[model samples]
Target: ADAQITSAKIISLDAGKITTGSLDAARISAGSLTADKLAANTITADSGVIADAAITSAKIASLDASKITAGILDAARIDVGSITVDKLHALAKNLVNNYSRTSDLTGWTATDGSIVTDATLSAPVHRVTTTTNRQILSDYFEVDPSKTYKVTLSIKCDSADGTRYFGLHAIDKDGTSISVIPFTVSSRTFGGASSNFYFWSKGGATGGWLNLEAYILGRYIDNQSDVPEGKVVTSHCRMPANCHRIRLRYLNYGTAGTARTSDHFSPTVTAVDSGAIRAENVIAGLLQSVTGNSWISLDNGQFSFGNGALAWNGSSLSAQGTFEAVSGTYLAKLDAGAVKLSNSGVELGYFSIQTAGPTGPWITAAAGASKINLAKLVGTGLYTAYQIDWGTTGGTSATHRFWGTVTLNENALYSGAIDCGAIAADGVVSCWRVEPHLDNNDRCGTTTKRWQAVHALEGYFNKLTIGSNTCWAAGSMSLTTASWASVSFGKTFPSAPRVFGQYTHDFTGDIGMLKIRNITTTGFQATIGGSGFSGIAANWFAILV
Candidate 1:
């Protein structure tokens, strides 16, 4: 019994430490053992025990076909470089058919020209055998009129000495060329120097067909002014390049045209280099507008306005005004004439016609051919100043009266005749009076007064030595002098003169006192007594009152 007990104990101990070969499927109890009882990474697909709830994600080393389920992966889960170009091309749409011309010009039509496939060129070439314009047009392509596109092409000369004119034309649904932009290429070598030309096109067709045309013609003469009407030419002296690799790219579109509503035009060409010809057209339009009433300033020296109306050339400024029928009153006007104010000195800022006083009302020119009387008054107003008035009353009229005060500074000079009243007024109404004020020695600050009724007088004193208070006259008389041998005074005095007379050669026998009776303001008359006197001489002095 002891031997049996010991053996059973050893057997039970060995059973608890059983090796992998000691355990069999039958030894394991179903639903009794779990994955928690095994070490980490001990259960895997190779272990049949993992048939249900097979290894959790944490136990896997990496993912593979056996680890992942079918149709469970998506683009987001797929790694990069897994997709091919063939796959992408199958999903996208190509707007430009036959973009590379893999097949010979299958999607293009040539008018008056033929497509020439050249080994040297990357794409098919357009060959023109005539001087007339030729075109290679693409099939009508559907496009959104509200979008803009960039059209590009590479151009070079195909034949040496064979210059060509090349341009891009946009045709609308109505078959009318709406926009045309062209350039020239001038090169003598095959595959000569070429330029990449780019242009913008705002889609024009509205629910209609739109197409692009490439035009090729003989090289345009440089600076040629006699281009045929309705014909396209290049302002530059370059031959067109062998154009190929034409492409259209999506750009900002949807811009409207300047023409009719619902009518769209191609996008405005904005390339500064290619659009120079268009600039000439724009300048021409501006010049036309200048012919009307528009004013254009060019630089600082040149300016123009209206149609031959006003212009300032490099030298002078010119202007013209039209003469229209006069209907109402005008203060001042220039009719069919021009008033130029060009001065190198101090200029008048403005002129005013006002009343005599500084605070007086404004004065307007008379209506029609009416005249306003003018008068000059000196030292008349409160300020005792000189004034020029429009009316006879010196700016005192109830209507149409104006005056301006004249303040003469020191050393001021006026050299002109003052037409007082008509000739009937004796041409002398007042004389300018300059008086120094006793208050100050300054002549400019002195009070000035004009003396009225002052007349001018002139005379000659002949051989007379008169005193300071008297004027003397003397002359000779012949022996056969008449009864009235007059002694003449050359000029007049302001008032009548008091005459004192004596004869140097007096008559002795029939002596007579020298009578000086007819005394006038100008001169007094003197006579000798006898007519038989010869070689007689007389002298007299006349004192003027």
Candidate 2:
């Protein structure tokens, strides 16, 4: 049993003095007695120290394929929700070639890993070196008939032969070239260097490079007025509606013996749509006058004539008159006939009978013919009576009572009065006054008529001058006959004028305005008489001159 325990005949054996601290892991046999073995935790707790430091095959744990899976050993497994943003970046760069979304795009490029740039289609890159050689680019235009576009080409010549000429053309879809613009490359300077065309090119180490760009711009068709600034025009519509493609090209135009050489060149052509409509700019200079015989229509559905009309809507009863083009100074060709002025063949006021005068408005009448003519009173007087005669060539005095109608036409030209007081043939000699009233009484009225406030007739004269509130005269008077006994201011007197003092009346109803006549006076003195009336005291005054 001791030999078996010591394993002399066994395949391996381990012998040692069993000290509590000794560890001889190599000396132990591979298949030791199973019942004598102790648990690892129990050995470690009881001994408080490890026996052997060397690792050997006898102490290894068993490996099982069933315990292992992809989650435990897969190198690249990731939690779909918990994967970090850095992982996504690496995935994007390594998995997708067009990771920045730039693939097969003609006008775009991956400027950075994340940004795509709009590489605007420019003029073809020049690759030739020979002189007088021309290169044409392939067709890359996408014509859209739904829109209209403008083709603009901007070029500059840095240092060129002075005699060299250059030109540009816009090739339409129909194989037609339109000369949109033409400019000269005169000798100029750019970037502190001498050049043939300052605006054509910029000189650098590679040689002189020119920047030529083209874009689809817009313009107003109706604005046939002026050119606009900036690379694009916004205020005008393009012509030939719904036309789109715009092509640009450069040509050489120069005198013989001069080469048109361009070192480096770039041309940009943009495809743009029409933007918002803009108003055309007004020209800076003064506007020229435009005259045409065309008629303008008003929005209110009315057309105005070359001339205008003067119409009274009868809004008020106040008197007013209209004036047509004048024929003479104090005369007008009236519309009505001379008979239109008569009420009847019988007189109404003082005079009787009527006949047309030389310059008629109010006609004259012979006494026996009936109808009073008011124009016969030629002197400045209150009630000077003159006889109408059918018996002689001149009128003779006649006394008769009458009644008549008086028409006051505002359009009539009379300096002082429209006197209609001579109607003696009619039974009642009544004279009606219907002057214009601009106040509360807009209509004419007999009761609102104003009576003259001064009485002085010392004239058979052509001119008269009255004072502010006094009546003075300077005309010849026949002191013998009472036939010339008439007052200057009033149409009638309460009594006769005893002497010149002052005169007044209650002529305040519709009697706001006054009209007085100036006639020739033969150096005769006139007077105002109003001392007797009480109401006349407030507005009464006297002046000699």
Candidate 3:
């Protein structure tokens, strides 16, 4: 690259149409160009000398493009202030009605029958002229003159005692007044003259009702202070104007002159506008509907509904569902899910320890020992009159047994007997029976203190069963006792002793040994048999530690 220095100032240059008075055309070679010789304007496109090309506007820079094809840049960047007022007219327009111009005094308060401004009355008192105490029956209301409004007043009192009377009065904004005759009069005898009170005069006959409520009590009768009268009632009244005060008086007749004038007999007034009252009613109606069309609550302990329904008492919510508690006993638990006991898929109600016994018929844990006497064991026919005992024996080697009739009831085997008892034994103890193993009348030798084993005498009879008749006399035995030498179930005949099994006495000494021998021709060797049985002999020593 070659560099060049210039002393003169260069104003402007156009690269597209290059023109340099100082540089000769021969200096700008066809293929040789230096950056120093180039003008400030850069070239944007290549000057091709080859093929035909279509350079669309989209291919050009935005600066060289038309205003309509400027893409996102053509849109206004700051549109907030750019929008005309006409386009924002809807959003800026006021949707709520202007309340100041309408002068809606429907529920607004007024002084007497006239509208009142910011004026207020101080001692605009009532003057009653009568020999007996009399109430200022009129000229009590005053309202702002600028607004038309209405008010509600509720009055309630005990029966009048001939000395008390109520009157109505109206006071205008102009300080003018008008009075009404005594509306209520009564004697002190019948609970004092008081009546439930409500009034509607605001609409004159068209506007909605004004709601008001009050409770008046006479100290003398209703046992109250201040008011001195025990009469309370809530009443609603609608008036066309606002109210300031009400005067009450007690009239005492004849020479007694026991009448008392109430300091302020005016029933309290609650002023409201018609629109607001309507809105409040609408809200109350909605609440009632959502609350299962129940009673609607209003001010002054009053409740009402669109259906003219009144609530005189309160109610409780109804129960929605029911449930049950599971039943159980010691060392037991109900399955997490329900387990069917009968046909019904009821949840498990009880869990108890497993026991073997009859559900009914025989008494439980029958008393006495269950004995199978060899003499009573018959060879054939039905054998009845058997006994079963569930009694506990108090002895070093206690044994329990049970037995009953040995009969086969149809295809089903019915064995009705009391629960067997526990037995206690030690060493080599053998047991033999005259009947079969299935015979209900079976007795067993006590191995443990609490064993319900079965056994019987020899020769007399045998146990019978639908299946193979278990010859009780000849059968195997188990080494139930921890220490046992040997045992033989059936009586060992002289020719050959039927030794089904045997057990080893795991200890020394005869402290836990047992021996039952010396049988005549009718007697035979009857001992327990099992793989663990050992030392099977007449004089064998069976030991248990």
TM-scores of the models, in the order given: 0.21, 0.22, 0.18
Query: Model 1, residue 380: what's the lDDT?
Result: 81
Instruction: Please state the error at residue 71 of candidate 2 in Å.
Output: 37
lDDT of 3 by residue, 346-376 (tens): 2222322322353323222212222222225
Alpha-carbon RMSD of each model: 22.9, 27.8, 33.1
lDDT of 1 by residue, 325-384 (tens): 333432233333322111232121112344237754443333221223456546783432
The lDDT values for all models are 0.38, 0.32, 0.30
Per residue, candidate 2 scores C-alpha lDDT tens digits across 371-424 of 342344447653424334334334354433322344448443235422232212
Clashes of 3: 93
Off by over 4 Å in 1: 1-107, 110-125, 130-135, 148-431, 435-545
The TM-score measured for candidate 3 stands at: 0.18
lDDT of model 2, residue 481: 14
Question: How does residue 387 of candidate 2 score in lDDT?
Answer: 34
